[model samples]
Target: MVNKNAGDIQSLTRMNQLYEKLLNEVDVGIHVINEKGKTIIYNKKMMEIEAMASEDVLDKNLLDVFMFRESQNSTLVKALKTGKTTKNIKQTYFNNKGKEITTINHSFPIKEEGRITGAIEIAKDVTQLERVMKENMLNKQNGKITFDTIIGRSQLMETVVDEAKRATRTSSSVLVVGETGTGKELFAQSIHNGSNRSRAPFISQNCAAIPDGLMESLLFGTKKGAFTGAVDRPGLFEQADGGTLLLDEINSLEPSLQAKLLRVIQDKSIRRVGDTKDKEVDVRIIATINEDPLDAVANNRLRKDLYYRLSVVTLFIPPLRERKEDILLLTQAFIDKYSTLFNMDVKGISEGVKTLLQQHNWPGNVRELEHTIEGTMNLIMGEDVITIQNLPGRFRSRYQAEEEPLVQGDEGDLSESNQTLHEKMTKVEKMYIQRVLKNNGHNITRAAKILGISRQSLQYRLKKFGL
Candidate 1:
């Protein structure tokens, strides 16, 4: 008595749902377009990569959303037209909102019975990674970074910096722990620059950047016959001999590699892949993790013994939200840095923009703040002030529209915000000193030592700021 096609329809619906799940669940962005250049399938990651919604992309023309009518930059279009596959191609494009996004894509043409039907492209978002690489390159080019290169003045930051400065005097393996974008590498570089190995080669690698198979040789060099196309080369450990080797995101390393790393730290030597003999190398290892080292060990992401070996000198960089005093300071600093770089007459941000920046929890920390300013300046046009209108959608979406921009005279929001930053710093200092005093039970010398200041200076500040 059932409909004849009921079973087929049910099967089809379930298949579509499974297909949808496959597209969305993958880590990489996926996009599929028909022969006519119309976007037929766009997955969740693609939406994140392009910063567009399903309504804006689904069933829309590719050229209309991403490029000019005849632009050749779209990989989706290229595969469709050529009926060929393009692998590991880096493409740079602006989204519908005009924000620059860079992705590494592998595009394949969908063919049915030897006829090209459509094309699918898988993409990995490399926009932030590219930006970070550029910044690291700049730091290396500019005589490397020191503690002086860091840009935080909050009490927590000051404490961390003081500890890091002390750590620079040691030859022990250091673990720099922090959330993503909190500048752990910066601290590593600073420690190296401040140490006696300042002139020696300082090499760094993000453990999460490469595949597990390649990571072993990357750290401990490979012999000529190590594997296919392997050459006799010095790895990061050998390259960083008598200097520093910074392993960023060390928790991402495989368990076997972690054991190897621990052995290397203990033995002060490394054995190249496919080589039986080990040679001594004097390399100061500085490892970074984007979480609490204890949590990393507890979660089995990091080995406990390896954690102890690396944590001989642990430096924890506070996230941006914990040190809110640095927000406006960083905002104005980035505004100035980018203004010069972009050759724009941009001066400052508006009060409403400041409210949004302070209100929003900066999950990505300082790097996110810098990129926010950079992205804002990219589209600021000829405007001197960065009003709320200049912010990206993620920030703007939560901002109230009715709020008016408040600028004091011709001074841009940034220059005016300097005073605001100073005021906020003073408030934070007052609050911190009070808490320290309370915690130390109002012992002036103990609180002063804890604050990294003289008791006299603490008394002067306490009275001067009426704390």
Candidate 2:
């Protein structure tokens, strides 16, 4: 009897301490009601949070003291009715100031002899969460990107965007080969954004910019005192583990380093510079080569083994000259950007300027065109419209001659038009196929890869065309 009495006293002391902690230290609002539905135990903070005094709530009928809207559900009532815990019950409750506040309520029933005695209710403020959810819904409704922020509407650009989205669905390495200014980085970013690894960090390194000696350290990282001026640092591969690492100008990698890159791609692991310890990484590699990678391999500038591994899902972006329809669309976008930055009131491009833009062959592609327009905007102060007179002098005269209509003699020269549509298609197909084949140095496997098709499919076509 003496031992049982001591144990009872210890239990009572612990319960009292728990009650005191809940009343004074807990952050959430807590309320306890008796079998008669009258307030038996409630926290001072709960009253202060509701902007009411203890006298206004203590010993009062709990249901009568608080007002609720008809739409608002009661977890405490449900807990009492069902004799179970109700979790994450959401509703809006009006404070003493009559302002509606959102909350998530949790409640549990107290029972004795299988009969419901009372219910304990706890409320958590969720106004911030509610606002965040609403804003996310609005952003979704607006059809804005939650990832890549690329903006373009041209059909060619759309195709590139679609390919980037498709690339994200696979874990295979993607090779984006394009001209210097054809938005290779944008495509890489879009692929990362659309991927499952978007939440992780995305790292980009320009292989052409880094020195041969430090390339390995930059890519695979190094330990402290691994070399001169070397502190312990995680390399791009370790930093981007479970995410993506884009190697821009990959063809520029030294032949020695290319072999190392191939091993990383094949094994999905890395060994830091001067460190014998090998570490496993799951980095998704995306490489961009401005030049023909196969040509680099042929000249012994790039390793053939690494070239094959990095060209898993190859995508080639056509130059601006080939996608002429996108020129005006990209022009307007660049104009809008420069207009905002330069604080100009320039409205639109004139008819003459449009004709000249359409006729000119953009050798430098999109980047050159944007720079030219930006330079033109700097020269003109107040503009009714951007005319041919405002354009760069070299483009104005050379391309201006191509815009004029030809005479009857020129119309009769239809030799170029006399070719049948089938013949024209064959010509285009042969040219593109030959380019791919030559770029891959007659390696059908590499050619098929560069063209983003199967080797067997290429073989069938090559046999059909007698090439």
Estimate every model's Cα lDDT from 0 to 1: 0.84, 0.75
Q: What lDDT tens digits, residue by residue, belong to model 2 across residues 1-467?
A: 99999999999999998988868688887877767777676776566556667777768776676657787656666676678897898876654444445678889989989898988888777765766676566547434233245555666666666777888898889988777887788778778878898888789999999899888999999988887888888899999999999999988888788888998988889998878889999999999987655556668877877877877777777667567887788788777666655545467799878877876657677888888889888767567378888887866667644334533452242234324564456557766898789888999999998888778668745643446
lDDT (Cα, 0-100) at 167 in candidate 1: 87
Q: Positional deviation of 79 in candidate 2, in angstroms?
A: 66
Residue 372, candidate 2: Cα error in Å is 1.5
- Top candidate on TM-score is 1
Per-model TM values vs. the true structure? 0.58, 0.57
Candidate number with greatest lDDT: 1
Per-model RMSD to reference: 16.4, 18.3
